[model samples]
Target: MKTAEYEIVRDFAAQREQVYAAWTRPERFARWFGPRMFTTPADRVVLDVRPGGAWQATLVGEEGFEVTLRGVYREIAGPGRLVFTTGDPDSPGDGPASVATLTLEECEGGTTMRFHQFGVNTDAEHAEQARAGWLEFFDRLAEHLAVQATSSKVSARP
Candidate 1:
């Protein structure tokens, strides 16, 4: 049997453009794209951030194990939405790919991000792991945005 699609909605206290940049920019993306316990080296990240472009990154765990994520952008709508196909780079052939759609909406105080990932087929254990990983990843992303917003505000002041 195939695993079900997963969707999550998160709100960030940052401008829509800022949140979008954090997701699309390689330098910023590598800082928070992995699970909470993993670290992504700056030199190991590559993000093209355009329709038909490719993005790749490697995450290193505390034990030095590496996980490579490779993806191709399917659609790009400025700072509002993005769709991509992603999978494990080390898998045989092209690996099991999933389509991810992320939509960002500007709200009263910030941005609301709706994320949906489909076409995932794995064992129950792996599906649960993936869900947990995404939750942790988003948690890290929120933290990164908070720090960026604070620093930006400080720098903007005289």
Candidate 2:
């Protein structure tokens, strides 16, 4: 048996509130959940961002390789932290639904986020790849935030 712990950090060019909004809001989520060179469009997405809510994503690429991921939101700390457990709740040993925590800290010019995932010691291989994929997605999120911030500023100009 092996254990795996993977974390991700990102500095977005937007305020904490905006960053948080992008995650909790469905429309915003559909916009940037996809990474560069990939598209996790709104059509193939389902997000319920509340305690005990479900989060699902199925990315269709190439042939019939569909990636289905499901999770439940356990704790939400406004624009600061979001905690969740992965895997489905109906099955025993269903990957244990590892606990994941995403925290946002206000920085000088923007927001810095730290993503911590635990309870992965039960399954190391899959968790490792998931972490890598998450990092890539975060990069795309950064790009989306940058553009969104610019748009917001432009719209606010009087």
TM-score of each: 0.89, 0.84
Error of model 2, residue 138, in angstroms:
0.6
Per-residue lDDT tens digits of candidate 2, residues 31-118?
6765455556676677787888888766665666666666889988879989877774344253545777899999999999999887
Clashes of 2: 2
Candidate 1 residue pairs in backbone clash: none
lDDT of 1: 0.84
- What candidate 1 gets wrong by more than 4 Å, as runs, is 1-3, 88-95
lDDT of each: 0.84, 0.76
Give the alpha carbon lDDT tens digit for every residue of 37-107 in model 1. 78898799988888889889999997789999988888999799999877732342534557889999999
> What stretches of model 2 exceed 4 Å from their correct place?
34-37, 88-96, 121-123
- Per-prediction RMSD in angstroms? 2.7, 2.5
